[model samples]
Target: MRLKQGSLLWYLYLDKSYCLLSVRNVKALVEYFHLLDVHGKNTLNDVLFYHFLHHVTDLKKRQINLVFDMLDWSAVGEIGFEQFYVLVCILLAHQNHLEEQFMYRHSRTVFDLLDLKGDLRIGPKNFEMYRFLFNIQKQELKDLFRDFDITGDHRLNYQEFKLYTIVRINKLQKRQKKTEENAERERSLCSRKCRIK
Candidate 1:
């Protein structure tokens, strides 16, 4: 799969990491490494690496510095393939672990925003107040509320709301994956035709 610009693969590339060698395209990886090796030294200095982290990721300054230190294992202000590979593995694992926590906390935040009354449940009245926040019609909102209110209580508790949001996100992700697959297929066919010509 061709990694998107903001995906984890791109981050690894930005770090000039070799950890992605097993999973990413060789040509793309080589191009990315060359892009980061600005001084033609075949290595990333502190300044260049900092610029990479600053531009490619939204990580905080502390986190960026931590990653930089991790990659510069020898404290010589330069990183090699082994350091990059290890950093990539650590970052990927950390991100995967945080994803679930982030999703759960985000769902709670959304549910709290929707449940304005502090009643631990989102009823039609509270849901109506947030209608302007959504693009769906009133009827659609009602139907959604009904579907989310799994216990037939005419209200959605935090758990029900969280589940509903997760399901919705999963559905959207599936659709996005299907679209991306179709686009990749089209690109492959075009490339084949070009080669034939």
Candidate 2:
């Protein structure tokens, strides 16, 4: 996946090399990935991956299969630690509603998974359809395109999409915080007062 230094993909696979994280943490992650290589083939087959996904994420059977197929970019029945690690990042980011943040930073991997066509660019509709992979509904996608299509060409290349994801995620977080604040206010005794027309 190009493996550029300091990139998200690079961080996932080579943070140990760079010594960017704790040595113990890196060892733990490496050991976990190795342990999943139950047959010692240095690759994970469907069974191992299925159990991994089943425990960590809410993906249905069909969705899990689809994810496996995509990660099996070689069309082989097994995938190495690099592929497995990419899936791990995807699942964690998705569970936290951070798809855009992860995708924007790891555009190459994200584009490979979601480009749908080999066209090197994507429209908001693509986001709408495939965002379900992250278990996210169609929130503000079209509006994002309309608002952030800075080139005015109605499609997002990697850089533009990165900017879009950052903005969209920031807005989502803001909305979530606002919702939490409003809920807190609603539960407060002083909030018993209501306005009447």
Candidate 3:
């Protein structure tokens, strides 16, 4: 996967040397690098790389193995700091891109599957098929369909469905932000009380 230009990871990769130097704790990074170099060879062998990945990500064993295969481009059975940094940036960027692509593809696929008549809209008859795919209650489905239909035509078009998803995502993000702010405030209050005590 090509890294998107102007992305955070791409910028970091472009000036990795400067970024590394700007780190607040260069000693910690160097220590971490040595820890991953299990054989003390200033590089991570497959075993050390596996442990390093496990420490950094919650990826499954198979997924970690796949990453290992991809990053070991030199066929040298070991990885250096540069290779590790590049692989990390690429994977992070790839994951972000994949999430966006997946959401778009998934929505399109679901619309195609549910729009049985190929009429670019899902009507009552076609919506029956949607019930099998989604475990939503019938009344909830009706309410959602009504809300998403947008034109009040009693049918959901792809554009309308996409708009609904966008609105839902925005609302969810707002709620999540509010929740985080509340948690931070509580933490701040607790810390202040502890300091006072």
Clashes of each: 0, 0, 0
**If both were scored by TM-score, which would come out higher, candidate 1 or candidate 2?**
2
Q: How many steric overlaps does candidate 2 have?
A: 0
Off by over 4 Å in 1: 1-105, 134-140
Model 3 residue pairs with clashes: none
User: lDDT of each prediction vs. the true structure?
Assistant: 0.59, 0.66, 0.59
Any runs in candidate 3 off by more than 4 Å, and if so which?
Answer: 1-105, 124-140
Q: Rank the candidates by TM-score, best first.
A: 2, 1, 3
Error of 2 at 77 (Å): 2.7
Model 2 TM-score, 2 decimals:
0.62
Best candidate, lDDT-wise? 2
* Candidate 3 similarity to native, TM-score: 0.42
**What lDDT tens digits, residue by residue, belong to model 3 across residues 7-117?**
333333222222223353334455667767768888888888877666655556665665565456566888787667645533443444332222233466546645655
Worst 10 residues of 2 by lDDT: 1-10
Top candidate, metric TM-score: 2
lDDT of 2 at 106: 73
- Which whole-number lDDT from 0 to 100 does residue 169 have in model 2? 65
